[model samples]
Target: MTAQTGSDGPAAPEVSDRIGGRLLAMSLVLVLGTFMASLDSTIVNVGLPVLSVEFGASVTEVQWASTAYLLAVVAAAPTSGWLAERFGARRVWLAAVAVFLVGSLACALAWSTASLAAFRVLQGLGGGLLPPTGQALLARVAGKSRTGRIMSIVGVVPMLAPVLGPLAGGTLLEVADWPWLFLVNLPVGLVAMLLAAWLVPHVPAADRASRFDLRGAMLLSPGLAAVLFGLTDIGSAGRNTPIAVTALVAGAALLAAFLAHALRADRVPLVDPRLFRTPPLGAAVLALFVAAASVFGTMFLLPMYLQSGRGLSAWDAGLMLAPQGAGAVLGSLLVVKPLIDRVAPRTIVVTGFALIIAATVPLTQLAALSDGWLVAALLVRGLGTSMIASPVMTIVYTGVDPEWLPRASSVLSLVNYVGGAIGTAGLAVLLELRLTATGDVAASFSEAFWCVLGLCVLALAGALRLPKTAPSR
Candidate 1:
């Protein structure tokens, strides 16, 4: 096969030609890095109470360990595209893994709450680069044609993180100290780095002479950080109080200014806002926002309902949620991928959202703690989520210029993170508001499920407008 430049730029003929050999190996290497990075994002939560007791800190004070990491991740995402362009994805990825490993070690060694929180910030900086860079690399290699199956593989681990994190954390705490939580990343990181170095190709970097969008970056990065921080506070506090409101408003205003700057700028900005003008890309982004809300929202709500409402243990709650991961993985491989290569993304996405709504509505009517009905609902929820996420994400890269993949990847990553935060916070607030008035666990959970169902409906509406087919390269 000959290399051909599309509306984007040079296609990855070299990598595409070797799809059965080195390309598969490199994909696995990148997937490994992404899985670890994504896992760390949620794995510390079950250990939070443990850390609180160990450090003699309160719940609110201890949360900053996770919050600081999230803020750092939001701040770091907008920079990943530029870093990949200037330095090449392979080099930047290797460095990211190394930095993550170092940060993990430092976190394990942290003696106090403040120290662990600070080290988490360090970890976040490295972790933030992994997702976007990995996506961009895979996008460049797979091009538009194969993004469906490839992203399915890359996304599977992250999708499983929420389901697996509490289980992993609880197990670790059961057997060892809190330090082991961070230390667990050590062997994984090392293996990923070695595999990446050995199997990944030296894809050439973009021209380094483009004036970096320093001013836009200044606005965008911190704006995202603020918005995410505000939302996180809302989720934790279970309210949209003064602090959350102020931060959200301020962050929204700054982001608006950045949007104006990016649209009007003569030079390329950090993320090319014009990409959103494309119909398919725009629709895909909207679907992504909704998809993220449903995924994170349900994950947040289900566990609370199981453990706090139904009085199950953390470990048991995690086990009950395990079927969601199984259904999601099965759907992605057996259903989403095949449909993507054959059917319209619009059909797949709309059907997926419909399934999500159908599955979630049953949560409102759930009566018993140990009913097999809950498991059945979760499995359908998983299938629906995989159907929506995998297809929408694959179509996102279709028709884009290859040179723009890095920035596009960054934009998607930022949106997913932000959307998940919003869903989590919004649902938590909803549940809290219901409980305050009613004090009924089942009623409050039902109210939250209604909110989730509404979000899924919005997603379905957006999916209706998606391109009828994947954009031709």
Candidate 2:
């Protein structure tokens, strides 16, 4: 294939003809950074209770550690493209790693809940950029023919991280102090940095004269953070609370303002809202949002059911979900390739969403007799998740111009983070409300299932709207 350059930068050096040693080495290095960055999102989950006790704080206070990180991540996502363009991808990537390492170290030494939360925000500053930046790096090299398969490999970390997080955290806590949770990233970070420095390509920076969209950034970052914050509060306090209601409305209004500004602005917006005019990119973005919602909701609820509902230990709860991880990995390895080659990408995604709905049905019933049944359901769920997630990613760039790849990545990442936050918070709120009426765990979880099922159904509808073309391969 002839190489085609984008306005922002040169195309990645071609690797399809020689995807062996050096390519593999480069991929491993990139995946290492992606995996480590993704891992931090959930690794602190099981540690929440322990940290709560250690700091003599309530669950609500300790929750900020996670919340703060999430908010920072959402805020940082839009800037990734600009940063990568202004600096070099290699330099920005290395800087992100160094920042993440420093944040992790600070988190380990945090003496109070507030201190921990502050450091988590710092950590998120780095964590937020990893996915989109890493994807762009891979996308540049993989080119059109190889994007789907390359994404399948790159997509593994985000899907697998949540599943593995609790297990790793629980295991570490068993043998060491809570600080080990953050400390653990040190070696991984060091190794990833070294590999990336040595193996990752040194792409030249784009020569665009346009500066970062500070105006758009002002509108988007705080707007998303406020909306997410409001969504999170819905779980703790009812929707009617003055704080939540005010935040939600203000956030939505701000986002609307940003959208209008982006549509008419002379300068490039943080993300071009006009991109949604493209049917494929729009459908893919919508599908990704809904899919992320379901994934995050399920990840949030399952561990709770296993630990609190089933009276299992944290370690055991994490272990119980291991089958889902296995199934997801298997799906990425086995299901994505053949289907993308033969079937419409939309069909694959719609089928995957259907499987998610099917898997979720049993959870709504919530009165299963055996662990075997639940495990099987989760296995199917994992397959469905991989099918939808990988395909949606491959399709997101369909109508997108090459110059906009970084901005596109930012948009998707922003949607992904927001969708996850809503899904997690929305489901938790539903579960809490259900339990309020009937103290029965099974009944509450059953009700919560309907909420997530609705989300998957919405995703299915979006998938149906996707364009009819297969990926470039």
Q: What is candidate 2's lDDT per residue for 74-118, written digit by digit as tens?
A: 888889888877776667777888888999999999999999999
The superposed Cα distance between candidate 2 and the true structure at residue 396, in angstroms, equals: 2.2
Poorly placed runs, candidate 1 (over 4 Å): 1-21, 238-240, 368-370, 470-473
Clashing pairs in 2: none
**What are the runs in model 2 whose C-alpha is more than 4 Å off?**
1-12, 15-18, 237-240
Please provide TM-scores, in order, for all candidate models, with all chains considered together: 0.94, 0.94
Q: Write the per-residue lDDT of candidate 1 for residues 164-251, one digit (tens) a residue.
A: 7777887888899999999999999999887776666666688553679998988998898888888888878634479988999999
In model 1, state the lDDT of residue 383: 86
Poorest lDDT segment (10 consecutive residues) of candidate 1: 4-13
